[model samples]
Target: MAARPGYRVAVPRTQPEQQAPPVQRLRVRYAKRGRLRFTSHRDFSRAFERAIFRARLPMAYSSGFNPHPRISYAGAAPTGSASEAEYLEIGLAQVLDPAEVHRMLDESLPDGLDVLEVVESPGGSLADLLQASRWRITLPGAGDLNGLVEAFLAAETVTVERMTKKGLREFDARAAVLSLEAQTSGDVTVLDVVIEHVVPAVRPDDVLTALASVGEFPTGIVPLLTRVAQGPLERATGTVRDPLTPAS
Candidate 1:
């Protein structure tokens, strides 16, 4: 566009954006607690980018017109669900001490979105290591939750329908469930669940729907679902180990 006689003409860039490739990758373990649990993954991404800026991190950026920080998120918990274990990886232009980065980022991010741990990634896939999750669901004023669990497990296939971007589809929620048990503490019924990561990842709501169909599920009462841990499942004892730890 031409400028007027007195107006200054804006100069267009002739060169592509230059950005450095990542020299190091750091894996982060964080928690979503309190009201921040309602923050969606997209929301957290934006918050994290801002935190990176505020913390002045030496983040590696992609090359081209729209260069962005090299950050990858794996196994995000569902929105409106509290989580003790969430994971992400960030590529850096310069290598930094994980502890230092952790402190910087923790201070930068908002309260309730806590950075629990940061470690230099060993050579392996973090996604591959996150094979399963241990989840806790609290049902208030619940009765006979143990019976419902037994009924759910006894079934060969417990199918539930969930509406996806593709539309509503039937899913076998029982298949991914490695273990499901309930323990009552006074008036509250607590559910301990270990579910394997599978295609068409099952959410806690799916399990609840399956339970509703298989047994008596308390209506008009919301369940408190929280992901306690995420990592590879130990087959022998049926536990989820920390994903960041390298195998011996």
Candidate 2:
């Protein structure tokens, strides 16, 4: 009898079983900052695929005509902003020594990108493991951020009108902001904002709205906004660095 479509005939076992155990999976954390941070998430994914090929890492691909390599990113950074800490995960075809894979990937990444660390991911996948992210936004000229930050903190609720695919939606920006702190860097003022993404997603737009409530936004494009770090800020023992630091 002929086999059904999309079905394969089972063959009798002829080979001996392997004596050794299979290799373990590895999860790597990579940081993309500076000019590279401005690249869109889709574009960055393509860039990393090419970089993986160049690095000769054993990346696994999906089983399809136009197969895509299995990879996952923790969160997306806004375009035009710099970031110190970003994350992505690449699953290997076979289990590899974490250190070796980390070394290979670091060498393959372009400037402004770095392999921060590599280890066995806590969960089955990176997406399952990620919980939250942290961001440090800098506004130009220290333009009355003191009043804005104070007002924002003192408010019971701050509502902002945001555009959604379903038209427009208004949300309490304060609810989205898990934490916020104010500081100054020479002339510019910085707001270290951390939002919980384990549930709802937060973006620079939310911050823009909150800032606008208490201060004036630049007439044109605003000053630099950079993502400082990502992932469970309190967890994960890895080498951490401030994104604003100059490349050594």
Candidate 3:
């Protein structure tokens, strides 16, 4: 059937991206130090993406038209809180030495966002291992922390309200608290506390609010909070075991 004098057909020229599943997954432990503690999660994400480019690591990308890096972050500390332990995982197209990646990433990022360690993931989810956190809260001019802590522990349920993403809500502050200890020096007091990660996420401020309700805690006292560690809760030792460890 050769009936047309002149006819042409347009054919699209496009192919699917050949992004592969990650061959190697590496978990990284980093620290948010100095003024960089105030960087929001979004800001840190952008900075980390830039660092990946600067380091020139071969990152694995997801399949599709708009491919993106295969990176995931777990249990980021709240904004404005300094942290010694933070965890993230990245998939790589080519296998690389974890130590070298750590060194390169540390060099690429700014001073404050320090790469503490990087290790090959044995198996399982990093987020699942993050069951608890240890924090040191320094309160200035807060009277008699020992008394306040004692009172807080004595309560069976200390209900407090906090403004969350879904508006105002109330939860039991005592439920999330695994342990609390206080040390006083001159006019300052430091609280060493272990908190279990729970729904609604009990924060240090919420604990203080619970204390105020339970005891005659002095007002107008400002506190500096820092997350020391976060990992699986070791029941026997009452400590957070390193999540990067294979056993955890």
Candidate 4:
């Protein structure tokens, strides 16, 4: 092939990639509720990365052939359950006000999945700050399970089997539970529980299994579970503190 007379062939040019250093790490408290709660952790991560890019935030990325956004997530709530408290930290190339970042990201994300709070990390890891979690389970059309709960709590160890990637394993669900109480409202019975963050991470279903192991749990009743809080446990109060809140 030959170039036409009085014409020049154009060559393609590649743009240089520029890397920026992270100036700030923002700790964020978010929520997974409603239909969005069904979103898997991997799905949420991908959506968040897309949101960060759509919002045009100067996010920091790791160094590698396949660099990923510098985002670190604390223990995430299980899928198919709603959560009021969830935590993650993101590194940014430019320093920005936490409140502004919160508002921008909140608007950028979809409904249901919300950014509740954002704070400037005071030089600590988010994973280490989480010690316990508060959960609420609502069983509709189910009668009170007070006696069943009492029996389960009285037992020294309530073992339950769960299928993990490794294989089926049994663990003591009683030791991880800090407190458990049943409350009734109309036709729905709600169970409020505070569980310590431990190995295997006993979920609400595990507690239900323990309850069933002792006594009869109403069959065909699917309960609604929600994680109300997650953070450092206050031994005196037997409750978790907000990670974003500074100690008094």
Q: What lDDT score is found at residue 98 in candidate 4?
A: 90
Output the worst ten-in-a-row residue range by lDDT, candidate 1.
Answer: 12-21
Q: Cα deviation in Å at residue 223, candidate 4?
A: 1.0
lDDT score of model 2?
0.66
* Candidate that would win on TM-score: 1
**TM-score: the better of candidates 2 and 4:** 4
- Model 4 collision count: 0
For residues 1-248, could you state the per-residue lDDT of candidate 1 as single tens digits? 77889999788878886787789999999999999999999999999999999999999998888888999899999999999999999999999999999999999999999999999988577888899999999989887687889999999999999999899989899999999999998888989999989989888889999999997788877899999999988999888999988766
- Which regions of candidate 3 fall more than 4 Å away from where they truly are? 1-15
- The TM-score between candidate 2 and the true structure equals 0.75
- Write down the TM-score for model 1: 0.92
Choose 2 or 3, whichever is better by TM-score: 3
TM-scores of the models, in the order given: 0.92, 0.75, 0.91, 0.91
Model 2, 2-92: lDDT tens digits are 9999999998865543322223455666666777777887887787788889988766765544556677676666666677666666667
CA RMSD of each candidate after superposition:
3.9, 7.1, 3.7, 6.1
- TM-score result, candidate 4: 0.91
Query: What's the lDDT for all of these models?
Result: 0.92, 0.66, 0.91, 0.91
TM-score of 3: 0.91
Q: Pick the candidate with the highest lDDT.
A: 1
Please, what are the lDDT tens digits per residue for candidate 3 over residues 1-248?
Answer: 55466775656969877887999999999999889999999999999999999999999998888898998999999998889989999999999999999999999999999999999988788899999999999899875678888988988999999998899999999999999999889988899999999998999878889988987887788778889999999878889988987672
